[model samples]
Target: MVLKYCLLLFTTLQFIQARKVVDLTHTYDKDVPKYPLGWLGLENFTYFKMDTLAAQFIDEMWIAFKKIEYYEHQGTHIDAPIHFGSGRQTLEEIPPERLIGPGVVIDIRNKVTNNSDYAVTVQDILDHEDEYERIPPNAIVSLNSGWAQKYPNANLIFGTENTSDPTTFHFPGWSVEACEMLLQERQVSVLGVDTPSTDPAQPPIYPCHIYLQTNNVPLLEYIANLDSIPPRGTTIVLGAPKVRGGTGGPTRIFALIDDDQEQEITSNSASRNFMSAIFAFMYLNVFRFC
Candidate 1:
């Protein structure tokens, strides 16, 4: 019976270890939509053939380079604290550990569908907590407003009838009350959104950004594929360029899924010790007999 159980546990461990990685980033191209604000979007990528077989600096050296210009906050990007808040930490000040963590996706797609100008409120957070329990500390809380499907559509994605007018823009995002709950009360480290900003478009002032930046919480904007990730139980890895004193920059975000539900690979030291004992028992008794 011990040997049988040991084999079964080993197989289960192997299965759990084979984690699946989901890319939660959008590919930025010329066609990709820019935020309706007056800033110029990504410049056309200019490529130059530096060397070839006939025009090579060395015998077998071939090289090419491209000049690309885009706003730091353009595409799938991270907004460091210094983006808005004065005397706050920049991109480099955010430690690597803070960039990755267990994540929860707060989906407000239905609300967005009903009202494009809807804002995620404190009640939404409380409701999610009532259902899913308290969100883990230092977790990356992602707001999925279901706007990613309209990517590359400058008009639709920004929810603006006039691309030039910021006042006409409309979309779903975090309300000030919601930010207070998540940042001040829950102490979440990062806030990610599928939209252009954490606040609803056309806010009198970007209160969500102000609150988060003042509190030194980074924001990940223009994230894609939140529809694929679960509401909770996945680990998020943020890949962004670490520019010293950078106010913000583009980032690549991803997640690792191990199980279908709350069931996850063990990390508790006591559980690890218990598993070790089982492994030792199997090696000493079952393996020798075999």
Candidate 2:
């Protein structure tokens, strides 16, 4: 009996390890797009800088290191509630459990193609639920505007050659009403977007950021690889840094997808058969133990 239980546990662990992990974070570097400095009323600002700290040959191996400096929100990052809401949770204060949840990708690429300034509406959410299922509590809802393809190019990504001018910027974002429904009705934990801001570029007030952050919901911006994951069923894990008093910081996001779901997406029959065999073996082991 003891051996049977151990084998079952081992198999279960293997099954879990088989799940595909899609990295949803973009590579951070000096070239990544930065929020417009002009919008902050600053003429010049170094958003990201790097310097070589050490580069030498150790006793037997090469030793190299560098120092990096950048604003917390420069790259793919988390916007802690404190970013927009005074006295709210900071990066360190946010609960770890809140950083992980079921991922829901609401695709608005079609609408975005027609209008770069499109904002996700409540009806879009309703239509998503009609096709899929209701947005679950504590879910991480992300908007896929297909904006990531233009990343690293400030002009294209921001939809304006004058990247520093907020007035000329154009990008899709979440509408206040849609965010309100997710917070009030679905109780979602995180709101993510491929764009730089949670609110449309034309809206100087940033209603979505103010409203959602005040309600203690964090935001994930500049998320990459949304097109790589399924619309639903995957788990999103946000590896946010624990910076004391930080309003936001660069984050490493990952999508944990089940093997079956991955197989369905790829349509790999061999992988499907392998998963089925694993399940059959586990069932047989249970029967043998009983």
Best by TM-score: 2
Task: Tell me each candidate's TM-score.
Answer: 0.78, 0.90
For residues 1-290, what per-residue lDDT tens digits would candidate 2 score against the true structure? 77777677767767665688999988999898977766567767678889999899889889899887888876799999999998999999999999999999999999988899999999999999999999999999999999998897989888998877788889999999999999999999999999888998875569999999998999999999999999998999999999999999899999999877787788777766776686678668654665
Candidate 1 lDDT, tens digit per residue, 101-160?
Answer: 988899898898779888888889888888888999989999998888888687988787
Model 1: how far residue 222 lies from native, Å? 1.1
Question: Model 2's lDDT to the true fold?
Answer: 0.89
Model 1 CA lDDT for position 27: 83
Off by over 4 Å in 1: 1-18, 36-62, 262-290
Local accuracy by lDDT, each model: 0.79, 0.89
How accurate locally is residue 285 in candidate 1, as Cα lDDT from 0 to 100?
71
Error of 1 at 249 (Å): 0.9
